[model samples]
Target: MVVFFFVVGLEVRQEFAHGALRDSSRARLAAIAGVAGVAVPALVYVLVVGASGGEGLRGWGAVVGTDTAFMLGALAIVGPRLSGQLRVFLLTLTVVDDFLAVSIIGVFYSDEIRPVPLLVALGCLVALWLVGRSRQWSAAPYVGIVIVLWLATLSSGIHASLTGMIAGLLIPAYPTQRHKVVAARQLFRDFWQSPSASSARAVGRGLSKGVSVNERLHEYLRLPTALLVVPIFALANAGVDLGGGVVADSLGSPVTWGLIAGLVLGKLLGIGIATLLAVRMGAGRLPEGVGMGSVFGGAALSGIGFTVSLLVISLAFDSSSDLGRQATLGVLVAMVLATVLGWSIFKVAARRWGEETADLPMTLDSPVDPEVDHIRGPEDARLTLVEFVDFECEYCAHATGSWEDLHGRFGDDLRYVVRHLPHHPHGPLAARAAEAAAKQGMFWPWLDFVFTRQHALEREDLIGYAAELGLDVEAFIEDLDSDEVAARVQRDIASAEASGAKMTPTFFVDGCRMVGSYDARPLTEMLESSRRGGRTQAAKA
Candidate 1:
């Protein structure tokens, strides 16, 4: 009970602080996608079970599960062939999908309620909160208290594990004093002056000294829950015994059929319909170099229901019943099938799209644009560093400082070029904001803002940051809404593909690609080597 509550609390905090639900649109879309994915499968399961007169009809809801880890892992294996935008889209969709699945279990699957036990559960929660408030209790006492809460909740006919989620939300998770101080300082500079400024400064100072503490914590607490607890739960619960009649029964049963149909058929339909509607309505466009087929394929993969399905089944059915067994089998089979189909479709679709052609050798006789010439120089003192980066990529945000360092060190001698490779669907807006900042000659500052708040990079946040930077917010928004920005982003993506810069934060010094993260030492080595080579070539000439 303790662990589960802890995890749940953490997740709630994190979602508010950094996870997908922070973005209203992304969250809404994810909710929609998740609902369609779950509802279709569930409906199918119930119908099939009812038709066959099978026993697991009550457990139909268990069929709508999504294995984000497995799906993302599979996408990773598929490599750069899959568009970055699609990957981000899948991630956002899955996070919300998980949340919805959990809610369904909590609301619908609880046993018959007795008011006495429920009241006791609330009392226990209050006690636990008071204990947590002290911040002095050892982990042992908390664990024991949690166990008690779980038992109480279990006896109360409420799902016992829900105690974990409830407990997790009630706990406090605040950022360090240093971060608070930094935030205060930034806010003060951006917003207030005079008496307000003085007050803000005082608050900042207090935060710096770790003297003042805010009772309400910022939302990043969910990271621990999602990263730690969710995975553990998955590992513990997902190992089903596939031997004997279990396999046959799962295939033959309505529960299995419904799950399969919902996942395989519903996911694609929902995502496809939504995306098509968005595009048709002029709300969004297909990502550059990404086809409808690949998008559909990725959506199909969204049907991979492993972790949530198992959790739901556990909650909804008694262990001794045939319903539980059927639910388990259905989940496993549907997940396996979804994975295979999605992967195959993506692989074939990506191959058909052809390798990114930007990096290929070009004939010397090819005409060069004057603007391209203006940006290029052959001098050894001048360094041309091109970055293929996604605005929504966390890793890219992390590496933003490294680029800043290079800029500070090299100044005018370095020509840093940014090319868009928006990895997630939300990235394009961020990319547009950066471009808008570029129009106002504040691109770097805007870049800093977006990267620092990457976890909170919603469209409104992007626009708000632009406003904070003193850019014309309306114009910036209009530009983002324009196809011109998207075109520029696409050109950059094609250029990146040509240069073999497949991942975000990919750096090319001259023409040599640098993949993944690197500190000052390696960066310096690469730069120096490039300089030496350029000098040697000059000497030969």
Candidate 2:
């Protein structure tokens, strides 16, 4: 449970950093809906269980959230194709839901607090925060601190569940810096030339440092927790003997019925109505390719909670008690009921409203426009290659040579388009500079120059480049900081996110994305093959 919760924390933090939480409107929408989702269900749980005046009211936390892994897995297993945007929207929602769920457990379900050990744990978390902020690459101090922290938390009368989550939350998560990747590439080149053990070790260290600790831990821990820890824990703890009269008793018990109603009905109505109200009230809009029917179906799906629900059950009541046994039966029944309800809702919505789309959307959302977009070749070129790039991305810099090679091979036949997806810290600054240069008819030249000198992308350095290129430095600086330039760059960034181009250097050839290597040879071969198949920009247009 600790490991699983730790992975959950990592996922929520990732979403907060890069996914839904990054956008203000989306965050607002998610916040409103998340609060409603939890609040409405809690109300229902309290009402149902409270009226009976039973101890079952203690388990209200169980109804407030959907198990993210279970929910996402079920969504994938079921239909709803081309749901990339929906997935992002739901991921953000779950981040809020799960964060609330964790807080509830920590505050409501904990044992008596031990201030001494709790303070010690708090100090350890502060140390972890400092380590995370210091940007240390070595994992030794982190591992040591976390081990001590976990032990302290266990001794602090806090539930063992929160230690991992708190630790995961304290770890900083962010996009990979381009300079680190560039440095790693240099190390790899060195190892390629002089294949020594020392060189190999250097390459390994570089690669490790190129990625954030949060990502590394998530990549390593997610599978182990999912495949091993969760299954083992569920089997050992989640088992309830339904063969006896327990099912009948649960059916009659307010405890069982309260949980059932709260999850199945409350989650559905809460999320669905809250989402509709929020959108209608102009709080936020739904993700693209998602409609109300799909939202309703997904809301129904959210009721199938598992991990946290089970954890809450254990914390709220003893398994040996009648209330606990009844609650377990309710949860098991709710999973089946929610799944069936969600599946039925999806089928009905698909057939009645025609809102079904079960595959990922294949085409880019934003099409290339020659008038506004940078274009190197003729407008009537036979082939079109559109790339979304982060200016400070190392891979984008590495891929700059491919354009020349491709153009040299098929100069008149290909027109290349560049769009911004400035996901790094300095990417927006760099993109604005590029646009500033573009206003002076030097977009391509600036691209080439900056790709070579990626290390020097400060505002002053960009102005220096404009002067070196014999442009009006004053005008370039003015335009570089202009709102219009910022808006223009933001459009490309938004387009990149919506277009399903996840990485920098993503290439779309003749309106189709290239899935494999973006190297010159691979792209040339792809282009040649497309031509043989009678596919081209003009042909498609």
Candidate 3:
């Protein structure tokens, strides 16, 4: 169990450090839902079981967790529309959900708590934290200290599995600095130039040091933990005998029904209601490819609590007891029910939504102007969006919010072409700086950085960004003022003039020009229209 949770801990660290949870705005909805999912289920358990004023009231923790592994597997069974951002949202939610469950166990389920060993465990954690923040890269010392912490925690009467969570949190997540990476690359280049065994070893060591310890541990432990540790725990714990009168006894138990109501009804109401209120109140918007019905479906699916619930069950009731058997039975039954209910709801809702939106109007026009050069998209894309943008244009800067969404949502289906107008005083310099960054395969990032800090696109700012991106600072400065790059910017301006775009942030969907700044929804609709039109053409052919 400790080993299995250790792997789960590593994943949690990974997400917070570099994955979807890194963006608070994106993960906010999920975090809310997870908390609600836990809180509301416990409330429902209390309502249903607390009414009896018996041992059934002890089972509140049984419904506070979602088995992420089971939920993701069930999502796969349901189909692809359940993927993308919604999947990310759910994954993050489960991470939070499971963390809460573990914490609950540590706080509420432990026996014979000892302050001294617990404090020692905490001190070990602090040591790990300090080592993580320091320049130390070796894993041996961290491992030894963590083992001692685990033993100390075990002696302290805390759930030993918590050591995994603590250790995982302390693992370093960020990569080495850009300068270090660049220096390593330089060393490797030098080594290649000279071709010695020692230089090759140095290069290898440098390269290895560039990656974070968290990522390194994750890569090593993920497969073993999943295949061996988790399965072993499941095999050991999931063997509840349902023979003879055990089923009947379980059915008759209030504890069983409490678990059921909490898992099935409580989760559904909690997640669904909370999500609707959040979205309505502007606390959060639904993830992409998800609607109200999908939310309800996901809420239903969130009831599929297995592994974590089992741990909670063990803590809540002795395994040899009738209450424990009943709770386990309820968990198994709830998982099946949740899977079926959620799957059915999602499929019907997705189908209805798809049919409703199937006839979205076609906004297709001619192919993009091949003469204009700056582009980002797949070569064989059927649709293109061209932007005639000025670096200092406020509208253009605001318009990036929509463009970013379009780029992410449409990906390779819609090609994005950038053309410079250079209308503002600093526009020419910004455009030239972008062109120079393009020489170093960093045009898009440079463009994003420029817009993000549009007011700070001075020469020094451009030079600073160049240095930040590990570009040849001298070459970038030279190119920023060169006649060739200047001509390129002028040519794009001329092309925009030929297209009759007088504004700063003019856009063309293919060749059907749309002037001024727009929102993501309309742009999304246009892209969808263009895509459908292409498919229609193919069908005719």
Candidate 4:
């Protein structure tokens, strides 16, 4: 469990560094929704079980988590029809929910607090942080330290699994040094070009330093944790006996019904209603390609509280007691109902909205070609916003407002370029249409048109839009399938792949890659920080 949670921590770190949560503005909605989701379920548990006035009411935390593993596995059943935005939302929410659950356990469920061992654990964490900062290259030291930390934490009355989270967060999330990475790459190339054991060893060490520790751990542990550790955990914890008339008796108990209500109805209402309210109240907008129905379905899936719920049950009730058995039954029923309900809703949503071809996840080393790309600001600008976007993607459309604000505020200080990564079926056509319009010197306006009416970017619609823009319709139609235009869009796709973009509107500010936040203030702040860094480096030079 400790190893599993450590891996979870690693995943969270990676997400914050390079994935959807990098954009805090967009991530805020999901965080808020997660809070509401947890809050509602807890409230339901308290209300329903507390009304009956028994020890069974203590397991409120049981309804708070969506099994990260199960939720995703169920999501996979929906296949390519699942939008990237929904994926981001659910992933973000689950991670946050887990963190909250852990906090609750530490605060509310611990047996007895031990200050001495806890302080030792804290000291170990501090030492680990210090060692990591000083560039410790070997994993052996970390392994030994981790064992000691686990023992300390275990004896300290905190859940021992928390060491995983501590270790994962402490692991470096960035490369050691750019110069070392460059030198290591060169050496690795040297060894590959002319092989030898000595050079091979050097290259290995160099490559190790080139990647962050968290990333290495994540790569090493992801499969084992998912395939082996989590399953074993489920097998041990998920077995609940429904025989001996226990089911019938549990049916009448508030504890059993409360778990069902909290896990099924409370989670759905909390996440779904909170998201809807957030968007409607202008606190935040929903992610593109995600509709209310999809959000509701995803929220339903969030109710599938399996492993974590079981943990809470064990903590809240004596395992051999009637209350414990009843709560156990409730968790099982809730899991079954939530799975069925979520799957049914998502299947309906998939049919209504249609599946979009998802973008392949790529690395961040993709080449940028500002020279051949469409530019919207001065060439000599200090900050550049390189956006890899799908014309029909609603998130991209939402970002247009931010881009406009950026352009208005920064003017020539910021250079903007749009790159096409058409993953959807209609996406290639839309990209070519925009390219065709670019030939007619109406690329920006045509882009505005396509984004404004993103759902109507088909072949016929593209031609109509071109004609509406007063372009030579014949030339525009011919250019739509032109080899040159097709190649250009493909080039952008290639660049996008190289850059590790798995979703629309992947933005890069001064070569720093970020995904999905369209808030003007943060965008501006990032731009300013980049500009300052550049100026500082120039002055030093």
What digit string (tens of lDDT, one per residue) describes model 3 on residues 1-541?
Answer: 6666666777788888878787776577777888999999999888878867777677788899888777878876763432544566777878888888777877888878899999999999999999988956667777788888888999999997767676887887873454466578888998979989999988877776777777777788878877887677667667788886889998887788888889988899988898788878777766444567767777888999888788878887876578888889988899999998888877777687651111112222223554446677875687878777887876662334777788788888877888887878888888889888887778887877778677788899889989988899999988888888888778777676666565577766765655223557766666676677743332112
lDDT of 2 by residue, 426-529 (tens): 88899999999999999998888788887777878878899998888889999998999999998887776666677788877777766657778878877886
Candidate order, lDDT descending: 2, 4, 3, 1
How well is each residue in 235-348 modelled by candidate 1, as lDDT tens digits?
776665666677787677766676677667677776667766665665455434455666667777777767667777777675334666766666677677777877677666
lDDT of 3: 0.76
**CA lDDT for candidate 2:** 0.81
Could you tally the backbone clashes for each prediction? 15, 6, 0, 2
Find the candidate with the highest lDDT and give its number: 2
What local lDDT does model 1 show for residue 532? 71
lDDT of 4 by residue, 214-310 (tens): 7887888889988998889778766667788888889899988989999999999999999899888877766555677778888888888887888
Candidate 2 lDDT for residue 205: 91
- Predicted structure 3: clash tally: 0
**Span of ten consecutive residues with least summed lDDT in model 4:** 355-364
Among all windows of ten consecutive residues in candidate 2, which has the lowest summed lDDT?
532-541
Model 3, stretches more than 4 Å misplaced? 175-177, 184-204, 355-541
Q: TM-score per candidate, in order?
A: 0.58, 0.80, 0.69, 0.67
> Model 3 clash pairs?
none
In candidate 3, where is summed lDDT lowest over 10 consecutive residues?
Answer: 355-364
Off by over 4 Å in 4: 78-80, 135-137, 175-182, 348-541
Best by TM-score: 2
Model 3 Cα displacement at 213 (Å)?
1.5
